[model samples]
Target: MADNDFVPLTPREGAALGDDVYAVLGEAILRGTLRPGDRLRDVELAARLGVSRTPVREALQRLERLGLVEVAANRYTRVTEAHPDAYAHTTEFMTYIAGDAAILGLARATSEQHTDLIEAVDALIARSERNDGMGILGGTTAFYQLLIRATGNHVFITIMREAGLALQRNLQGWTQPDEDVELRTTRYRRLRDAVVARDGRAAESILMEPEPSALALRGRPSLG
Candidate 1:
């Protein structure tokens, strides 16, 4: 990495410091600031982030756990290639989990929460209309975040929070068919209306259906 490429961060102290570093570096990787096969040296990152090497190493360890980076003792630590299968698996995982979350959350959501979810789904529909890939990705994530939060399951919330970065990376470049955008937009509208009506089963069924993607969620081929 070039010296100019590394952005310095304000120094932080204590346990949360590690998390901040992890987020910074993880976001860098996701945004292609740190591309695949790029090497990471703790000392350099420590200096760049204005922290001790220990926290930099800790951050790297966390990234490695998420499959964003690969590490070898006394060898090298580098960003991993964006595996095609990861995208398929992530979508599959998200489809089912979001379906379940919808059922639980819609049952428990207040009127205010229902309004927020409807707004989020509206954003998704707008993004779909323009075929905005990244916008759709972000809007979908936000909509689901609200849905999951409504479920009031702490463990589920924590798990999804931990997996958020990996999910973003894996879902990058994932898109549905152009022809199906209108269909999906209709589905999203139905989904929004279902949530507004507090029809949990209808919302869940809409989300659980397979989208128009090469990587079909239903009966997807397993990796060897």
Candidate 2:
């Protein structure tokens, strides 16, 4: 999907439809329906959503803020391609949130959360050991997601939480898949073990940089 779809949902008339718009339209964009540099028609988008232009406009505004849209006064709105600046900005923002959560997660995560995290890590390791694609990778991804939640930061957790589909798309684009999932699975263990040890720095480091060797199995590069 186009990066436009990552717009966070905003409440509208007491109903949160932004995610629906962002998710559906974003999926279309990712699947190449609404591609980068494609002009967006507000009225057309509203009609598609069966809503007024306000929500469409709001969604576009959020997308613009996210660096996924470019809007000109009374002229046009369009999806924008990924740029280094955008990536650096967004990744920095995400990393900040993640770092805070890592610190807090190490301190505040409950014993149950730690146990759940360990189990998830074990699952990931098993997948890496098996070294399979589309199956173990899928499972390992789920486990990584659970680790994010164990951090106990609700907002960042929510943001990363909704990123499941998006992450799948990104992984498919940037990561390599192989017959053996076990090596990749061990990365999860590394992160979890750090968390289990209450070493926030170690956990965050594992997150900031994963095992390149295992990632190479997927044969994809980093995404913007």
Candidate 3:
């Protein structure tokens, strides 16, 4: 991570201090500043982030739990490599979450949120047509964010928030299938219609459709 990128943390009480430290290190890892296999020294991080070693240790533990870091007691702590199967794994998790969130959120969404969902799906289709990988990823994430928030369930919101970093890192550069652009666009349109009608089941089904790339990855033999 760049030395100047972080500033010293002001005093805070309880878990908030550790939470702040975790967000800093977690963001660095997601942005590729602290790359896979980079050593994480508590003392160095503590000094750099201007916090005590305790919070640094706590942060690393949280990152480890999130699979962004790995630790070996008394030997070393380092960022973990993104496994070759990470895309498929994270995508599977995301599909299920998005599907369920759509069901619940559609039931509760306001008319304004319904309009937002339509626009979001349109953006997804537009990005797909342009074959813009990053744009597609961004559009898809934004759609899911709106849906999850519409649910107004703290548990769903917190799960997505906590997992958001890992999801972005794993799904970066995700694109709609170039060959299946027409098919994907059709599905996206259907999804938009489903949202307009507030058909929870229909929307959930569309959201749960597996991407061709994810299917291909799942079929590949395990590297392990």
Candidate 4:
């Protein structure tokens, strides 16, 4: 591959060097700038990001745990290929967990939290309208993060983060450009109303609705 094929990454500017490295590398992988089977060498990444090998190593290990990267002992590390079953299973888990969180959130959310959730959903609607897949994903994640946090359960938050990462990875390049934006907006509006009304059952029901199949994964070969 040409040098131009690789996207340049800047040095860490945040206090959490490990987290900063992980975020940059993870976004690159999710955006397909780092494709499946692409070599991820600590020395190379450290140099590219102007970070030390320690943080790069830590970031790589974290990505490995998230199922985004695979490592061969003392040999190599590379991005993992997509697996349909893994995607399906992870989506299912995320949906259930998010539904529970929605219910809990509605029951526990303060007036201010309700306003924040509404804003997040509004952002999601806007992103969806423009068919901005990454923006939509980010907005949806933020909305759910609020809900998960409202539950006051650290374990659910952790699980959601892991599942959300896998879900986003599987959804790379997937967009419902022709899907009805109005319908989506209305559905989320109903969910927001339910949350505001503190209707736990309704919020869960709204959130538990089936998701469309990932057309992007339809013809892709699954990794064994």
Candidate 5:
């Protein structure tokens, strides 16, 4: 990847290098943008990111923690297929985001935010009904990004940066075969309602219902 492709982080311009690196690079790896088994050289990455080895090392470590990248016997680093921990961690993290958003969105979100989220859900559900997995994947990410934005919390933004990468990784599992669009969209719609209604309880329930569908939703979310 070209160094210019990187969205640079300035301490003053906002965002931490390590976390930004973790989230951006992690999302690329997860979404097949980087691809499985792609070799990564720290020097090359550092150059591309316009940062030194320090941030790259930190990013690699964070990715390793998420199971998005692995070090080979020869000391080469490459993206890998999802592990059990990846699935577990991604799900848990997403639940945290949704739960937090639900709690904060209640009083904090403007009426416009609620309407926009509901509209996004409707659009996503419509696209999913068309059996467009790619569309669903992209839309889902955007919807959640919006959810985090609605919270108006800086932490949510960072959490979202991390979650975006995990979400893309989860999407990979869906590319195998046609997923049950109806079922998935149904869940998404319900989840959207919970958010709009500011119903943290129902949103929590919606989050829990998708575990069995993890394999189908793979490459985008954690597998059950």
Candidate 6:
């Protein structure tokens, strides 16, 4: 795609400016608005976002570190193509980390935090009903993020931040078509109930259940 063809991002009102830019650009990439091999020009993005080139550059660098974008000095900066094995690897990592977080979170979470988790699960069901791919992605991320926060493990949080981005991108690529809204809601409801009951083992089991997409990734001949 041409440089001018990239979708423009609106300047966000709150939070750190760089973080907002990173989120907007990252979501665009995850949504496939910025496809693989599409070049990212900081000057154009800066102009489009009504920000200085600094944050755009910073965001681009952050994306590169996440393996979402490739930057070759003086040559180009482009969105990276999906790796065929990424889905399996990411799901494996998320299963363990998120499962552990669920156990710890159940142990650590306060009454308010339990309520927040239930609310997050409700939001996930709502997004699934609407078949909103991005919403589903964000809601799932938020649910796990809350759990990770409750664990108070900064190291795991950092790891999730890095791995979660790739997982979201891969999920966005494959999840929508086969997403069963009823099944998803049922699964999340079970998870929420477990967390609310402080049933750590049950919560872990629910979270670790093999996702359809992960199973497909293992069996499919090709991602294409």
Please give, for residues 1-224, the per-residue lDDT of candidate 3 as tens digits: 66786778876666488889988888888787888899999998889888899989988887887788899999999999888878768777778788788899999988888888888888887876766656766677788899999998999899778877777677654544545667766777788888888888898777666566321211232334
- Order of quality (TM-score): 1, 3, 4, 6, 2, 5
TM-score of 3: 0.84
User: What lDDT is reached at residue 123 by model 4?
Assistant: 75
Which scores better on TM-score, 3 or 5? 3
What residue pairs clash in candidate 1, if any at all?
Answer: none
Better of 1 and 2 by lDDT: 1
- Model 6: lDDT to the true structure: 0.74
- The alpha-carbon lDDT assigned to residue 218 of candidate 1 equals 31
On residues 18-131, what C-alpha lDDT tens digit does candidate 4 reach at each position? Answer: 877788778888777888999998887776677779998998999898889999998889998877576456556656767788788878887888788778777766776666
Candidate 3 displacement at residue 202 in angstroms: 0.7
Instruction: Give the higher-TM-score candidate: 4 or 5.
Output: 4
Task: Summarize candidate 5's per-residue lDDT along 1-224 as a digit string, tens digits.
Answer: 44455555454356777877776687677445687788878788887767888888898877876667888756799887666566546555665666666666654777898788788778777876787666765666666666777788887777566555556575444442445657777787777677777786776567556444321233443254
Highest TM-score: which candidate? 1
Q: Is candidate 3 or 6 superior in lDDT?
A: 3
TM-score, cand. 5 vs. native: 0.61
CA shift of 185, model 1, Å? 3.1
Candidate number with greatest lDDT: 1
- Please give the distance, in angstroms, between residue 82's alpha carbon in candidate 2 and its true position after superposition: 2.0
lDDT of 1 by residue, 59-122 (tens): 8998998899999889999999877688778888888888888999999987888889989888
Winner on TM-score (2 vs 6)? 6
Off by over 4 Å in 3: 1-5, 10-15, 173-176, 210-224
Model 6 lowest lDDT segment of ten: 213-222
Better of 1 and 5 by lDDT: 1
